[model samples]
Target: MITIQYAIIGGTGVYDSGVASIQKTVNTEYGKVEVDIAEVEGTSMVFLARHGKEHGIPPHLINYRANIKALQELGVQHIFATAAVGSLNPDYPTGSLVVLSDFMEMTKQRPLTFFEGGTDDVKHVNMDDPYCGNLRKHLLEAAKLHKIQFKGNAVYLCTEGPRFETEAEIRMMRKWGADVVGMTSVPEVVLAKELGMCYASVGFVVNMATGMESGPIQLESIGDMLARNKEKVNKMFLDIFSKTLDQQNCGCADSIVCL
Candidate 1:
C-alpha cells in the first residue's frame, strides 16, 4: 500500500535505480506489475523495468496497458522513462544523451490505446505534446541544477522489435525525420497519454543505426552509454520529483476526451 506520485519506466539497459528501495506488486485488470518504491527527500517514486527485470520481455510483447494501469492504480501522476536508442542522426553518436522531444510510431500488432471501445468508453488522446512538455521542462531544470550533461533534444521513432532493423529500413527512417530509433516507446507513450499521465523520457544513444555504421549491430557493446549515464539520469528524475510540481504548466492531464 505504497502511495507514489512519480514513476520511472526503464528501457533497454536501465534496470535498477541505483538506490535503496523496496519492491511491490500492483494488480491491475490487464495484468500485474512489479515496481520498486524508493524515497528521495520525502517524495515517493516507483521504478518499473519496461523489459522486465531480466530483460525477458520483447518490445512488442510488453504489456503496456498493464504497466500504465498499475502506475495509475498506485497514484502515479508523473512518469520519467529512459530509452536506449540507436542514433540515426550523425550529430547524436553513441554515448549522447538527448531529451525526447517528439516521437513517430512504427509499431505493429500491439494495443495502442486504453480506449478500445471498452467500459471506459471511446476516447481520443491528444498527441501534440505526447511526451509531456511539463515534465520535460522539469527534467531539463533538474539536469541543469545537478550539472548533468545532456547533449540535446531528439525525435524518437518507435519500431516493433525483438529484431534489429535492416539497412534499407534505417534509410527510410532517417528520411522520416527520426533522430533516434528504439523498440519500446510507441504504445507505452500512447497509453500514458490515454491515461492522462504526465510522461517524459530521456534517450541514451547506444549505437549507430543498421547502415549508419560500417559493421553489423553488436549487441555486446550497446550498453556503453547506458552504463555511463544511468546514474545521472536517475538522479535527475529523482531531483525533478523531489520538488513541487506545478500541474498547470501543461495540458498533459487534459489529453483525454470523449469521442
Candidate 2:
C-alpha cells in the first residue's frame, strides 16, 4: 500500500514519469489505472499519464474515474494537472503557460460523476470554485520564482475530442470568454472536486486556435510545438514541488457534502 500526498496528471508532451522510483497499476471499479510513485526534491508524489504512457488513449476514452479514484485511494490531497492547449484568446500566445482559474465544459459525452448509483441519494457537488485557489496561488508563486512568464488566470473550455475543434467552435469559445481550449480537463477537474481534493491545472499554449492563424491548421505543428516547449512545463512543476507542495489552506477537503 503506497501512500502519497500529491499527484500529477501529466498531459501531452509529458508521458514518462521523470523521477518515478516505483510504478504500479491500481485496480478500480472503472478500470485499471497505471501510476508511478516518485520522490521529487524530497517530496513524495504520484504521477499518472493522462494519455497513457504510450499516448494510446484519446481524451474521450481516458478512464477518468479510475484515475481519480486511484489517487484518492493513495491518500492524495492536492492534484496538479498539466495540459497542452490551444490559445483561444490572443493575449495568450503560443509557448505561454496559463494556470486555469475556471473551466467551461463543452463535452457532449462521458460520465461526469462518481455518485451515479452507489449512494442512497443523488450527490450534487458544489462547483462554485472548480479550481483550487490555494494550489493555483502556489503555482503562480512557483512561476514567479523561476521568472517564467505565465498568465495568472484563464478560463479553460474543454471540448470532447479525438478531433480538434473547428474555427467556428473556437470563435464561440472565445466569445464565451475562454482563454484556452483543450479536451481532457472537464470530468477530470469535476471528479477531483467530488473527492474533496484540491485540483489545479497548468495549461501550455501549443498553438493559436483553428482560425487564429491565416493558413490551415497544421496538425503536425502542434506536436512540434509541445516538444519544443515541454521543458517550461517541466520546470514549473519541479519548482512547485520544491517550493509550494505543502500549502493547503483552502476548503477543498470540505467541498464534498454528500459522500
Candidate 3:
C-alpha cells in the first residue's frame, strides 16, 4: 500500500509523470487508477494525469469519481490541479496563469459525488468556497518566489467538452462572471471536497475564447503556446508542493457539514 498526502492532477499539455520518482497503478472500487509518486525538495507527492498519460480521455468522459477515490484511498490530503483554459476575460490574456477561486458547473452528464449510497449515505458538502483558500495562498507564494506572473483569483467556467465552446457560449460564460473557461474542473473539484481533501486549481490561459479573438481559434497556436510555457508551469508546481505539505490548519477537512 503506497501512502501519499499530496497529489497533483495534471491536465492538457501535462500528460505524463515526468516528475514522479515511482509510478504504479492502484485498483479501487470505481476502477484501476494509475499514479506516480515522487519526492521533491524533501516533500513526497503523487501525480495523476487527469486525461491519462496520453490525453486519451475527454473532459466529459473522465472518471472523476475513480480518480478522486483512488487518491483518498492513498491517504491524499491536499490536491493541486492544473488546467489549460481559454480566457474569457480580456484582461487575462493567453500565456497568463490564474488561480481558480470558484467555479460554475455547466456539465450536463457526469456523476458529481461519492455519497450516492452505502453506509456513507448522501452528503451535502459545503462549497461556499470550493477551492481551498489555504492552498491558494501557498500557490500564490510559490508563483511569487519563481517570479511567475499569475492572477491571484479567477472564476472558472467548467463546460462539457471534447469539442471547443461556440462563440455564443463563450459570450454567455463571460457575462456570468467567468474569467477562464475549461472542461474538466467540475466533478474533480467537488469530489475532492467530498473526501475531506483541500483542493485548488492553477489554470494556464492557452488561448482566447471563441469570439474573443478577431480570427478563428487556431489549434496549432495553442499547442505552440503551451509548449513554450510548460517549463514555467512545472516550476510553479514544484514550488507549491515544496512549500505546502501540511494542511492541518485548513478548513478543507470540514467541508461536509451535513449527511
Query: Which candidate leads in lDDT?
Result: 1
Question: Over the stretch 165-256, how does candidate 2's per-residue lDDT look in tens digits?
Answer: 89998888888999999999999999998898989988888888889998765557667766655666666776676654543587777776
TM-scores for all candidates? 0.96, 0.92, 0.93
Residues 208-251, model 3: lDDT tens digits? 98999988876676667676666676767767767646667677
Where is the poorest 10-residue window by lDDT in model 1? Answer: 217-226
lDDT of 2 at 101: 90
Model 2 clash pairs are: none
RMSD of every candidate to native, in Å, equals: 1.4, 2.0, 1.7
Model 3 misplacement above 4 A: none
* Residue 106 in model 1: lDDT: 86
Give residue 120's error in model 3 in angstroms. 3.8
For candidate 2, the lDDT comes to 0.83
